[model samples]
Target: MKMKNIRYLSGTGVAILVISVFSVACKVISPDTGELALKDAYKNKFYIGTALNERQIMGHDAAAIQVVKENFNAVVAENCMKSGMLQPVEGEFRFELADRFVEFGEQNNMHINGHTLIWHSQAPRWFFKDDQGNDVSREVLVQRMKDHIYTVVGRYKGRIHTWDVVNEAILDDGSWRKSKFYEIIGEDFVKLAFQFAHEADPGAKLMYNDFSMALPGKRKGVVAMVKKLQQQGVQIDGIGMQGHIGLQYPAIDEFEKSILAYSDLGVKVMITELDLSVLPSPWENTGADVSANFEYQQKMNPYAAGLPDSVDNVFQERYLDFFKLFLKHQEKIDRVTLWGVNDGQSWKNNWPIKGRTDYTLLFDRENRAKPVVKSIIQAAQQPHSDEKKKRKQSI
Candidate 1:
């Protein structure tokens, strides 16, 4: 969840072009390169997608869709109409860019996932304040929430495949992360938000997204909350685990438990905002000033030195392991969308939470696919290959 300063000038804006950097950068096999890992991980499924904006959708960043066409089965636009992009002004709405993004997905025949109808971050300033800077009333906030959801979702009714109706609402310890929306709307706001989104786009799948707290207590909380919502018939549809992993923290096993617990609700589960960073690094933290461009990291960036070439190999192996775990639970998994596209476009590169350089993402700064790309593609093309061998030997 990092951001770079991008100016949206008038005119044809930026000419977006999509290029394939896969064939040039990564060889299917090298004469002396490391052997391929994960014989078979993703046999019957494939969904390789990255987050996209207006410039990215039309501009020359075809790496996302190229991977989709080659490997991924789904595509998610990270911030299509967050408060900043859609309702920068209270009464006014903007859809020129969001419309174009949807059109691109429709034209390309890609499954479009609309990221975030509600979030504690990246929202408009006017959302919390009145003309004289007074906090708006609860009733007013509810109306505003309904209006925004109505206008946005009503516009894209059947077009969007899934909506992250709520994002990052929970804290690392599994409690509400207190925001203006919560202040105005209260705890019930969660239920209300989903209810409104469901009313607006009945066909679009609705998901509640959060990060951290993958432990059983966390799982218990999510399951309990979603279950209550289900009991109320809120049309929750799914739960999104925002797989923002560091070198450690929500250990691999914890992630597995989350997948199983959320899927027990008989709804879909998606890895929404996914990026890994080797920590002891600083990341950007923004508040109040929307135009702020401060590099605020709690620690130093890990990839300051050029990432070692062999580390690239380690990255590929890690991808194999992660995908294998996902494939093992493929029955419960519905989609896995990368948080950003390339090293250059990732927030990990600049502002607040810089990972120094290309610490995350499938492609490097040049948009070339790395060993990670190869490992993921290989796994997706061959699901259960390893399991089959084991079963055969037993027979």
Candidate 2:
């Protein structure tokens, strides 16, 4: 149970860097249960999960799959459940990958989360177009939305515990993104999507997920939108703040405000798609828009060789800070899911700035637990605020 000073080697027998940024011999084992797993360490606090890539789900990457089984209690499909992936050509459905993903979670006794029911990006071209390639009428789009949701949600009604029913519909400035969904159907699209999803699976938890959540404009916009959904009696269960963060931006306090704000809406606050990048960003501000792309720059890809010890210290501390915040508000938070299982398969590598080697996950490419994992486990062992107050009163 005690995993200390463990040095890992790649399949090619290259020695992976030792995770020595923490104490000389860090321990990831739970103090009480002695289980060295994220799911076990935070079992009482909240669900700790990771997004599984197709490779991991299809049994291609045995090492990553083992890491997931050992650490996470919940799994969300990385790409398979997206609208385009599921229903590429109108009525044609592709459930092979998605079916395997859900089955993997079920076999492992993990919470199965549907990545997305609807989104502007990765939606099939046919979704917003007519047979002649013109933009479909609002009425037609609405019907299409309902059909897609009902079919996808209904397919895994009782199995998928949560669905990101709508994603990134609003921009950082508290305005609608003018996406095909918004352009054709207006803001009613979100409401209708939620309604359709609820009709499909009344039991599954529905969420509105977006990025750049720490921005004041974005926070207010989501608060208002969710409030409207509540007023209209829509079945929205949670808000997923995509934690696609960097080392310095999104000050912890600013991020905390968004968490408290969303929690005030009386819905579960989930830190979904959580990943912290150690590399420098090219943009002054960046949100998780799949369309945004920048030319590959060597300057941006500085850490190609490896993340230095100095950067690792800062990275570890930042993760600890965020996890501590989640622990502080564990009552309002439902789950914290990493976007990918490990650095090797992370989407961050090709996002925004393409071909950048970013160390943006807890496990390294070699499937070794970084030193920060130990610190996080230890932090979870600390008593909650209420517990501490009671102990002080007793003293």
Candidate 3:
């Protein structure tokens, strides 16, 4: 790609713009600390995956998936099989797309994590209602939850390594969010959700994921919630941290505290939605974004500062710093997932930034891993296979 002239905040003294891909003129954003070379450290220890479109998955030859599978042990379908996305209308399940996705992982012997079983958003509205133009009865809701989990999880069985069994079920305060499950099933919906998932696929790991649990208030709430569930014999296997940091929030120390707290619960933890946005603020008001959902946000601005080569260096550096902490506690850290394939697809480019573009993913549009990607891969390393496949390709 040719360098394009770049400009931002035009002339604001505090304004900072680094050398974006398109910019020809160099702007001193932050001093470069040279390449972090993270891929080496992370090699063999983990897998990085993206939810690709049908084309990106099926269009690739074995080499594509092999390329990715060799680097990590797991791959996840972005949205092919989510409840709402798959079974938008009752009894009309669309399994073709997801079917192909799993095929790739199975062929490569990669650990596949079903993106989710339940989420308030992206679900077909029908689940919350019924045939008589009334809300579904509690029994109906429970059955639906059971049926969905049983079918999906049962179908995959030993093939799927983990199911985000109950996603974002807890509100930021750590109380259960009143999703379709809550509205129809009343309460204790979280327990039932996990219970059903366990029964469906006893072999697969089960997890509850949410953002904001990395703060003191919510983190404490999550800890309390997990303890209660464990006491009842609920099979909660993991907690997804949904690492969506932004321009000045959460104070790194606070985020670390959240990790330690969860680790103490003896439940495995992961930075599920790991994306850092250099987007603007008032992000507090953004809607339906992958990073800043209507449901969660980091309290303090997480993304603090301009993009100097040094700060840009720190931006990438900070990512590894957290990873190092993650490695320090690897016994409890299970996985780290980047929300999208590359910067282009990140919801951040448009969300809180509104119309302005944001560069925040580990890979650029060309499919080459970026500095951040290398750092993550290098922070830790383990053993992997010889499989080689491109994780993302044109469908």
Q: Candidate 2: list runs displaced more than 4 Å.
A: 1-35, 390-395
* TM-score-sorted candidate list, best first: 2, 1, 3
- Could you say which candidate leads in TM-score? 2
Put down candidate 2 lDDT per residue, 65-103, tens digits, no spaces.
888888899999999999999999998999999999999
TM-score for all predictions?
Answer: 0.80, 0.91, 0.76
- Model 1 scores a TM of 0.80
Q: What is the lDDT of candidate 1?
A: 0.68
lDDT of each: 0.68, 0.89, 0.67
Worst 10 residues of 2 by lDDT: 14-23
Q: In model 1, where do residues sit more than 4 Å from their true spots?
A: 1-43, 60-71, 213-217, 282-299, 381-395
- Candidates arranged by lDDT, highest first: 2, 1, 3
lDDT of 1 by residue, 1-395 (tens): 11222244333333221112442454333211133211212324534456775567665666544543444445677665686788999878878878888887788777788877887688888887889999999998888889988889999999998898887666544565678888887877889999999899889989988766375665777787788788887898878887666554457787888888898888877876677654343333211112335454534654566777666566656656777777777767777777776666776565344335656776666655666666675555553766687789999
Error of 1 at 48 (Å): 2.6
How does residue 300 of candidate 1 score in lDDT?
60
